[model samples]
Target chain A: MSVNILLFKITLLFYSVATVLYLVDVVRRKEKAGKTGKAARWILVGGFALHCATLLARYLEAGYTPVANLHESLSFFAWTLVGIFLLFDIRYRMTVLGAFSCPLAVILMLIGSTAPTAMKELNPALDSWWFPVHVTLAFLGNAVFTVAFVAGVMYLLQERMLKSKKFSALYYRLPSLDVLDSINYKCLSFGFPLMTMGIISGAVWANSAWGGYWRWDPKETWALITWFLYAALLHGRLTVGWRGRRAAIFAIIGFLCLLFTFLGVNLLLSDLHSFKAMEGP
Target chain B: MMNIIVVGLSHKTAPVEIRERVAFAPTDMGRPLHEMRALPAVAEGIIVSTCNRVELYAGTHAPEACVGQLKAFLAAYHGIPAEQLEEHLYDYQGEEAIRHVFRVSSSLDSMVIGEPQILGQIKTAYGYAAEHKTVGSVLNRFLHKAFSVAKRVRTETDIASNAVSVSFAAVELARKIFGSLDGKKVMLIGAGEMCELAARHFLNNGAASVMVTNRTLERAVKLAEEFQGQAVPFEEFPQRLHQVDIVLTSTGAPNFILGQEKMEEVIRQRKNKPMFLIDIAVPRDIDPKVNKIDNIYLYDVDDLQGVVQANLKERQKEAKKAEVIIDQEIGQFSRWLENRDVVPTIVALRKKFEEIRQGELRKTFSNLKDLGPKERQAIEALTAAIVNKMLHPPTSVLKQNQETASGSDYVDAVRTLFDLEIAQEEDDSELS
Candidate 1:
C-alpha cells in the first residue's frame, strides 16, 4: 500500500517476468543463440536496480538499515542473490544458470512479500554501523552460496544422467561436472572469507554492545555451524581432492545449513538476532 | 532441352572393390576428359571421384546412348569387363540428373548424410574439369547452381552441424564435459584403426597432445611418430594415465585392461581433474563400474553408438528441411536448362534471317550506288525492324514454351524447320 512496498511489487514483477523469459530460452535453446537470454538478463538488471531503490527508500524513511525484520531480510537476500547471479552470468554466459536462479529469486521475493512490510522500529542496541556491514557481508556470502547450490544440483543431475544414460532436457541444458565443480570451488573460496568476516564483525559489534563477543545465542551458534560445514567441505576439497558428485552433495548440505541459519534460527528461536520475535509474536 | 545425364556407381550401388577399380585419378583427369569428350553423345563432361562415389556428369544430346557409352567407357578405361561394371552403374537423365548432382553436392547422398567433405570434394572435381576445359556452358552453369544450392542447404538447415558418426560424437561429448578441448591430453591405448581415427578427431578438435600405447612397443612408436606424439610403453601406460584427460581404448584383449580400482587411483593421481574414457573395443577394456567413480566418466562403443544414432535422428530432421530447399531450387535450375535449349534455337533462327537480309541488302546497295550514306543507314534500320517484326510470333512462342513441359518439342520443331541445328553445329565447332 505504501511507496516502498509499491516499489517492491514492481521489482517483484521485473524478476518474475525475467524468470519467465529465462525459462523460455532454456526450453527453446539447443545450443543456439537466442534473444530471450539477453532480454532476461537486462530485465533482471532493471529489477535489481529497482530492488536497490526500494531498500534505499526504506533506509531513508525508517532511519536505519532495511534488513532488520523477516520481510526486509528476505528481500535483501533475493536482491543480493540476483547481484551475484548476474556477475556469474556475465562471466559464464550460461543461460541455464539464469533460468535456474531467476526463478529462485522470484520465489524468495514472493514469500517475502507475503510477510508484513510495515516499517518496524529498530532495536536501539542493534542501531550501529556494524549492523549494515555485518549483514551485507553475510548476505553476499549467502548469495554466492545460493549460486553454488544451483551449480551443485546441476552437477548431480548431469552426472546422474551421464552415468545412468537416462538423459533429459536438463542434462543437455546443464554444464559439465568440471565446469560446475569449478564454479562451486570459486564460490567456496570467495564466500568463505566473506562469511568469516561477517561472523567476526558480528562478534566485534556484540562485544562492544552486549559486553561479550561470543554469545551462545541460537543465531550465533547456527551461523557457526553453517560456517563449520562449509569449512569442512572446503578443507576436504583442497587437501583430499574431493570433487564432482561427492563435492556437489556436500555443497548442497552446506547450503541447506546456511538457509537454516539465515531463516530458521531467526524465526524459530528466541535470540538476540530475532527481530520479529522481539515484537512479542 | 539440354540433356544433363549422370552415370555413376556410388556406395549405395557398388562394393568398395568395384568402385575403387572404376575410380579415376584426380591428379590426371586430362586423358579421361579427352576420352569422354570424344564420346558420340557426350557434349561436355566432368568426372567426380571420391572414396564414396565415382560419378560422371555429362551434357548429352542422346541420353540413352550417352548413359550406355559412359558406362562402357568406365569399364573399358578401368580394364574391367563391361558386364561386371554394368550391374553396379546407375544412370539418370534430365531432371533426375540435376537432382542427383544437387543431392550429392549437398551431402544428402553421402554414406554419412550431412557430412561436409562431399561438398569440398565436388568443388575439387569441378576445379579439375575447369582446368581441363572439359565442362562447358551447361555443366559449368549447373555445377555453380549446385554449389549455391549446397550453400543454401547449409545456411537454411542444421544438418551438418550435429555429429552423426562415432568418432565425431565422442568429440561432441568431450566438448560438453571440458567446455573446451584446449590443452587437453588424449591417449590411445591400442593400435586399432578406429582408435587411431578417434584420436585424430580429438587432435583436430584441439586436444593439446596425444600419447600412444600399444601392447607392442615397436607398433606404439610407429603410431606415435605418425601422430607426432609420445609412445608410452604398455607397461607404463597405467602410471602415465594421470597425464591424459581423454582415454580411447580399442585393444583386442579378452579381459578388462582398466579396472575400477585402477581408475579410482588414476583420478586421485590426476588431482580430481575429470577424465573422459572411451572404450572402443567390443569386449570392453574399461570396467563399467568406473563410470560410477567421481570425476571419471566411462563410455563404451555402445554408448558412443547411441549418441551417434540420436544425432543421426536429429540430422534426419534437418535433412528433411534441406530436401525442401533442394526441391525449390530445382524449379529455378530446370527453367534455366529449358531456356538454354530454346535460346540456341532462337539465336540460330535470327542469325539465318540476318544472313538472308544482309545478302539481299548488299545486292541492292551495289545496284543503287548513288544512294547517300544517310539513305544507307535508313535502309539498314528498316531491315532490322522488319526482321524483328516477322520473327516476333515464333520467338514469343518459343520463349513461352521454354518454361512448360512441351518446351523441348517446340525447340526441336524450330531447329529442324529452319535447319538451325546445322548452324548451331557450325557455331559450336567454331567456338571449340
Candidate 2:
C-alpha cells in the first residue's frame, strides 16, 4: 500500500480508539471516567493529524485536490466533520458531543476505506481552478450539517427521555435542549450559506465548462432539492420561531436529504458528476 | 471490641407524634451531642434528626450500657415519659448498626425508598457532629464511610435518578424536553388546587414566568397575585397560548377545553415552538389528540401517576441493588473497624494463644505425675513468655497501624488464620 493509504488506515485506528474511549465516557460518569474523555480527545487530535497527512499525501500524488471519487469524498467528508467537531469541543467542552460524533467519523472512515483506492489520471476536460473550490465548499457545508444531524438526534433522545419521563445515563450526559437547539441553529447559519455558495459556484463552473449554467443533472437537481429542504427548515426556525423538538426533527430531515444528494445521487443515479467523470468537482 | 450502637425511632418504627417530640433541632445539635458524649460508655455520638427519623449513632465499647443510657437520655431530654417512648424506640449494635447507617444514608431505609434528601440530611447531621467535636476517630471514619457508600449507591445504581411524585414527574419531564426551564413561560388555565401546585413546581424549577387564567376574573387575579404573575382573562388565554412554553389546565370543565383544532391554530401562532400541556383536571381539560401534534406534549394526571409509579418501581429495583452495595461495604468496613481496633485485636490474639497454652498444660498435667507447684509455675511462665514474644512483633505493627488506618488486609488475614469469629462468639456467650 502507498503512504496515503497507510496514513488513512492509521487515522482509522486512532478514530476507532477515540470512539471506544468516548463511548466509555458516555456510559461511565465517574470522576475517573473524566480522564477517559480527556484521553479520547488527544487520540482524536492524533487521528485528525494523520487524516490531514493522508489528504496532503493524496493531493501530492493525485496532482489535484483529492476529493474526486466516492472513497475520497467520504474520507474528506469525515476529515472535515472531525475537524469541525474538535473546534466545537473546544468551545462547548462537551464530551457527550464527542460520544455522538467520534463513532460517526469511524464509520465514515471504515466505509471510505472499503472502496478500491488505486490512483487514476485526472481527466483533461474537467480539470479547472473551480473544481477544488466547489468541492471544498460543498464538503465543508455537508460536514457542518453532519454535526447538526448529530445534535438533532441528541435533542430528540433528550426530548423523548424527558417527554416519556424515563431517563437513562445518556440523558444526564447529554447537554440541555436549549444548548442542542442553539447548536442546530448555529450549524444551519454557517452550513446553509456555505452550501448556497457551493451551489452557485458549481453553476458558475458549469457555465464555464458546458456553456450553460442550468443543466438539470441528477446531482444538481438533488442538491437543489436538499437546498430547498434546508432552506425551509432554516426559514421556519428563524421567522416562524420554530424551536426545540420541531427544529431538531427538521434538521434531521434536512440532513437525510443532504446525505442522499451527496451519497445516493453519485452512486445510484447517472449524473454529469459521477465517479465516471474521472475529474470530480 | 468497639461497637457502633444506634438507638432511634424512624417513620416505620414510630408514629410521627413520637418522632416530632424526640427530634433534635439541627441548630441546637451541639447541646445534645455534648450530652451524648458525656453519657457513660458512649465514646462518641451523632444525632441524625430528619423529619422521618431521629437516630442517635453512638460509638461505644459497651453497647448494652451505652444503648440503654441513650434511650433513657432521649426521654429525659425531650421531657417525655420513658415508658411512653420505650415502645417506639429500636436499637441495633455492631455490624447491624453500621449496616443500618449505611442503608439510611443511601436512602434504602427511606420512607420513600431511594429518595435523595436523606443523604444530604445525613451529611448535614454528620457536619453538625463534626462541628460540635463530638465524633471521635471511629464515628468520624464510620460517618465518612457511610457518605461514600451513599455516593457509591448514587453513581453505581440509579436509585435517586427519577421522580416519584406527580409534580416532580412534571418538572422532570419538562426539564428533559426544554433542557433547562430557564426563560420558559408557564400558563395556568384554571384555579384547581392541583393545577396551582403543579404550576408552582414549574415556577420553582426556573420556568421564567406564570400566566394565570380562570373563568372568574377576580379569582384569576387572586391566583396570579400569589404567583406574582399577570392574570390573563379566560377568553383571552387561548389567543395568548403562543406566549408560554408550558400550559397546565385543571379547571372543572365538563368537556374538553382544548381540542386538536384549537391547538393546531395555537401551534401555528406560536410558530412551532415546543409546548408542554399538563391536564390535571378529573374531566380532562385537554383533548388527548393534542398530543399527536408536532412539538406538543400532552399529559393528564393519569400519565403523571404512571410516571410516578414506574419511577417508584425502578427505585424499588435500585434499592435492592443499594442493599447489595451496602452489604459489600459493611464487609469492607468490618475489616476497617478491625484494623483500627488495634488494642482489642491484640488482646484477642493474646487470649487465643493463652487459651491454647493452658489447654495443652492441663492435658500435660493430667498425663504426668504432679510436677511441684514450682515447676507448674515455671511452665506457665515459659508459655506466657513465648506467647508474648510471638505476639510482640505483629502486635506492635498492628499498634503502629492505629494512626495510619492501614493494615486491614493484615487484620483480616490474622482474623481468618486464628478463626477469631469463633473466639468472639465464645466471648459473647460468656458475657451474656
Candidate 3:
C-alpha cells in the first residue's frame, strides 16, 4: 500500500485501540484507568496527525483537494472531529468529552479506509479554491455538532444516573449533567456560525460551478436539515428558555442528522455526489 | 427454619413524638442490640437508628419471642412501659422482613422518597452488625442482595432525579435566572438553614462572593465560614443588597423585615439591575410590594413551593420512563438469579449421566476384548446411546425441577436412590 493508505490503516488501528480502552474504562468504572483515556486522546491526536498527513499526501499526489469523494469526506470528517474536540478541551477544560468523540472519530476513520483509491481524480467542475473552503468549513461545523452530540449523550446518561439516585461506577466518572448541558450549548454556539459560513460558501461555490446556488442535492438538503435543527435549538434556548435535557436532546438529534448526511446519504443512497462513494479495503 | 424479622415505626406510621420514643441514637444502638440478641428467641440482632425512625431487625427461631422482646427493649430504651410501646410498634416477619429491607435500601421508605441517605444508613447497619458479630450467612446474603437490588433500582429507574428539597429548589430556581453563576454576587440574609443552603448552592455554582448578614454577627460569621463566604454586619444589608445580583433572606423575624421604601431605594441605587430576592422566612422577610420593581424578582415561601411542586411534577413525568428502566433491570437480575439456581443441578445431572456412560463403556470393552478397534468403537457408540436413553428422563426431570422450591428435595432423593451420594460428596469436596 501507498504511504497515504498505510497512514490511514495505522490511524484505524489507533482508533480501534482507543475505543477498546475507553470502553474498558467505562465498564470497569476505573477513574484511574480513565487516565488511559488521556493515552487514547494522544493516540487520537496521533491518528489525527497521520490522518492530516495522509490527506495532504493524497491531495499532493492527485493535484487537487482529496475531499471530492465520499471516502475522502469521511476521512476529513474524522480529522475535523479530533480538531474540534481539541478546541473544546482548550476552551472548556473538558477532556472527558473525548470518551464520546474518539469513538465517533474512529468510526469516521474506519469508513474513510474503504474509499476506492482509483477515484482520487476530480471531475472537471470540481476544480476551485471555494470547493476546499466550503467543504472544509462544513466538515469543521459538522465536527462541532458531533462533539455536541457526544455531550448531549453524556448529559442524558449523567442525568438519568443522578435522577435514579444510582451513584454507580459510570456516574462518578462522568462529568456533571449541568456541565455536559453547558458544553452541548457551547458546541452548538461555536458550530452554528461555522455551519452558516460553510452553507453560504457551498452555495457560492455551487452557483459558480453548477449555475445554481441551491439544487437541493442529498448532501445540500441534509446539510440544510442539520442547519435548521441546530438553528431551532439555538432559537428555542434563547427564546423559549429551553435548557438542560431538552436542549441536549435536540443537539443529539441534530448530530444524528449530520451523521446521516455524512455517512448514510453518501454510502447507502446513490446521488449526484456518488463520485464520493467510499470502498472497503 | 428460624426467620429474621424487622418491626418498628417509621415517619409514615407514627407521629414524631412516638417515633422519638422508639428512635435509637447512634451511640445508643449497641446496648439495645446486645439486649435484643440476649433474648430467648433472638439469635442475632441489628438496630437501625435514624432521626425519623428506629427499627430493630432480629433473627430468631422463635418469631413471637422477637415481638415481646422488641417491645420490652423499646420500653426500656425509652423509659416507657411495654404497653405504651405496643401501641406505636408495627411488626414484619419473614418475606415481609426481606421486602422491608429492600424498600428501606431503595429509599422508597424514606421520608423523602429517593433520598440518598438511606442506602448509606443501611450499609452502616450492616457494618455495625458485622462488627458486633451479630450477622450470619443468611442475613448477610439477604442484606447484600438488598443492597445490590437497591443499586439496580437506582441505575434502572429515575427515582433519584429532580426530587429537590426546599433548599435545593431555591438553588435551582436561582440558577434558571442566572445562566451561569461564574461571577455573580449573592447576598444571604440571616444564618438560617435556607440561607445556608442557598449560599452553598451559589458557592458551588462559582459565585464570585457571598455576603451573609444576620441580626446576630457571630451566627452570620459561622454560617459564612461554612460556605467560605464573607459575613457582613446586619446594618450593611441595605447597602450590600444594591451590590449583589441575588438576595436570599431567611430569618426568624416575626414581621416584614424589608420595607417597600428600603427595597425601592436599593433598586434605584442599583440602576435597574436584575435582582432575585428569595424570602424563605415564615413571616416574609422581603416586602412583597418590592415585586413591583422592573427587575426585582421576589419569591416568598409560596413561590418556592410552587417551583418545588413544578419540579416534582416534572420528576413524576420522567419517573415513568425511569420505572420502565428499573423494571427491565429487575427482570434481568431475576433471570440471572433463575439461571444461577438451575446451574448446579444441570452440572450434576450432566456429570451423573456421563459417569454412567463411561462405566458401561469400560464394562463393554472388558467383555469385547476380542473385537477389533473399529468394531469396539462401534460397540462403544451403541453402549453410550443406551446409557443416554436410560438416564435422559430422570436427568431431565432433575433439570426441569431445579427452579422449584422442592428442587433440593429431588436432588437429595436422587442421591439416595442411585447411590449418587458418593458422587455428590466427591463434587462437594471438589467445590470446597
What DockQ, on C-alphas, does every prediction get?
Answer: 0.41, 0.32, 0.05
**Candidate 2: C-alpha lDDT:** 0.86
Worst 10 residues of 1 chain B by lDDT: B423-432
Q: Each model's C-alpha lDDT?
A: 0.87, 0.86, 0.72
The 10 consecutive residues of candidate 3 chain B with the worst lDDT sum are B333-342
Q: Cα deviation of B306 in candidate 2 (Å)?
A: 2.3
lDDT of 1 by residue, B1-432 (tens): 569999999999999999888888877899998898789878789999999899999987678888989988998999999998899889999888989999999999998888999999999998988888888777887898898889888876778875787888888789778878999999999978788998999999899899999999999999999999999999999999999999999999999999999999998898888999999998889899999887787999899888788778878888898988889878777865664587777987898999999999999999999999999999999999999999999999998876543566687688778776653354334223
Task: Give the Cα RMSD of candidate 3.
Answer: 12.6
**Using DockQ as the measure, which candidate wins?**
1
Error of 3 at A64 (Å): 4.6
- Which pairs clash inside model 3? A69-A276, A70-A276, A114-A279, A115-A279, A163-B160, A163-B161
Which sections of candidate 3 miss by over 4 Å?
A1-281, B76-79, B173-184, B189-193, B204-208, B213-245, B250-300, B311-432
Q: In model 1 chain A, where is the ten-residue run with the lowest total lDDT? A: A272-281
The 10-residue segment of model 2 chain A with minimum total lDDT is A26-35
Per-residue CA lDDT of model 2 for A1-281, tens digit only, reads 88999999999999999999999888862223487899999999999999999999999999988888878988999999999999888888888899999898898899999987877777766678888899999988998999999999999998787666556767768877778988999999999999999999888888887889978998899899989989998888778887787788888888898888988988899778888886533
Chain A only, candidate 3, TM-score? 0.90
Q: Which scores higher on DockQ, 2 or 3?
A: 2
Q: Which candidate is the best by lDDT?
A: 1
| DockQ, prediction 1 | 0.41
